[model samples]
Target chain A: AQTVTQSQPEMSVQEAETVTLSCTYDTSENNYYLFWYKQPPSRQMILVIRQEAYKQQNATENRFSVNFQKAAKSFSLKISDSQLGDTAMYFCAFPDYGGSQGNLIFGKGTKLSVKP
Target chain B: NAGVTQTPKFRILKIGQSMTLQCTQDMNHNYMYWYRQDPGMGLKLIYYSVGAGITDKGEVPNGYNVSRSTTEDFPLRLELAAPSQTSVYFCASAGADTQYFGPGTRLTVL
Candidate 1:
């Protein structure tokens, strides 16, 4: 079984400030991919960043980066210089065992508010 | 390219009604998926297709059925609607680890 956990239900960050959203996952597989998706008012699921379990380096996308602790089963996202456009719900996800295209297991999600 | 497209942007159905949500991808990806997002929650997989004529159930498949006659299309069917079935349905196509999502369909069951 695979599970992803996002402990924060909601968070607020001022513009230009930084905020970090935490995520922890459980997976028996030695190789897999972890993802962060952003859902805004439009309800579109947008891929933010992804981290491979075998990689020692964390993944980064412009202002968004992840602190991936593979041994601790943790993958946390950090947004630098927050903007109002960053307000949305963030979800951590892991693919079910099989391959990269397997079913995705998602965390409940954390609603983020970027205050101007 | 139109990565993934879903029909019926929004719909309202009475209890016990039936409907089919359409999804099409122009990317010709061999892997496609259907997921539903309930209010205040993350998306849950309902079904997925590896290729033409190949389909499998996912995390939440009880109230839904799906078919993949061609690589470009994967439609999800709801035989009998219920209030609990109200959710935003998303269609996605993946070439590898990353999945490209459709805009989504918001369905309300009355």
Candidate 2:
């Protein structure tokens, strides 16, 4: 079984600053996928970014990026130029190579507050 | 396109009551999943279906039942509801990598 851990319970960042949310996982498989999902006040789960384990280079999308360390089983999400709209509960998730189709194991979540 | 729709956005039930959480997707996705979200805890898979008539248990399958009679509809049934079952339920559909999630149904058991 794979488990995702988000050590940080709550985080805050000033507007226009940068913030990093930490995440770690336990897994023996080499092929897998990591994802960062955001849930705003609306309670809608939105995909922020994703990283493939085979890729050495980190994945970047707009202001969201991921620091994926396969050896350490660590995949962290970084948000740059943070804005008030970015405030939400962020969750880290993982999908195993072989198992229930597209089933994801998620961390408890980190509540991010963007201060103006 | 109404990618995925869940009925009865909110509901309240008494202990031992039974109800069904309806879910439907218009994407014609082969895979559909049911997950529950609690305070401070991220979503946990309750049930999943690879296709119509094929359902499997997930991490948290107790107190829950699901059926996939058609490609678009996958409904979750809860029998003898308990306080522990009070949480937000989300239905999702996927093709390969990305998944589309519904607005979610919030259930309260008192």
Candidate 3:
């Protein structure tokens, strides 16, 4: 069984600044996928970014990037030039390589507040 | 193309009541999943199906039931609901790797 952990319960960042949300997971499987999802007040879950375990290079999408350390079983999300829209509940998720799809294990979310 | 859709955005049920959370996807995805999200907590998988007529238990399967009689619909059932079952439920579908989610259903058990 894979378990994801998010240490930060709540985080605040000034608009236009940068913020990093920490995440760690325990898994023995070598092939897997990691993802970052954002949930805003609308309650819609949106995919932020994703990183494959085999990919050594981190994944970056616009202002959202991930620091994936396979050896340490760590995958952290970094939001650069954060804006008010970035204020949401961020979740770290792990998906297995072989199984029924969409069965992702998620970590306790980190509620982020972007201050003006 | 409606990626994923869930019905009854919000509902309240009394103890021992039974209701079903309806989910549907039009992308012809082969995989469908049901997850529940607790406050300040991550989403926990309740049930999943790889295809029609194939269902499997997930992380938190107790107090929940699911059926996949067709490819487009996967409904979750909660029989004799309890206070512990109060949470927001989400339905998702996957094509290959990326999973698409619905708006979610918020259920409160009183």
DockQ of each: 0.67, 0.78, 0.70
- What is the lDDT of every predicted structure here? 0.93, 0.92, 0.92
lDDT by residue (tens digit), candidate 3, B1-110: 77999999999999999999999999999999998988878888889999999999987899999999999999999999999999999999988687889999999999
Sort order, DockQ high to low: 2, 3, 1
* Candidate 1, position A14, lDDT: 97
Prediction 3 TM-score vs. true: 0.94
TM-score of each predicted structure versus truth: 0.96, 0.95, 0.94
Give per-residue CA lDDT, model 3, range A1-116, as digits (tens): 66889999999999999999999999888987899999998889999999988989999999999999999999999999999999999999888544445578888899999999
Per-residue C-alpha lDDT of model 2 across residues A1-116, encoded as one tens digit per residue: 77899999999999999999999999988887888999998888988998888889999999999989899999999999999999999999888445677898889999999999
For candidate 3, the per-residue lDDT at B7 reads: 91
Question: On residues A1-116, what C-alpha lDDT tens digit does candidate 1 reach at each position?
Answer: 67899999999999999999999999888988999999999998999999988899999999999999988999999999999999999999888785435778889999999998
lDDT of candidate 1 over B1-110, digit per residue (tens) = 77899999999999999999999999989999999999898888899999999998887899899999999999999989999999999999987678889999999999
In candidate 2 the C-alpha lDDT for residue A73 amounts to 90
Q: In CAPRI terms, where does candidate 1 land? A: medium
Name the weakest run of 10 consecutive residues (lDDT summed) in model 3 chain B. Answer: B37-46
**Clash totals for all candidate models:** 0, 0, 0
Candidate 2 per-residue lDDT over residues B2-110, each given as its tens digit: 8999988999999999999999999999899999999778998999999999999998999999999999999999999999999999999987687778999999999
| Worst window of 10 by summed lDDT in candidate 1 chain A | A96-105
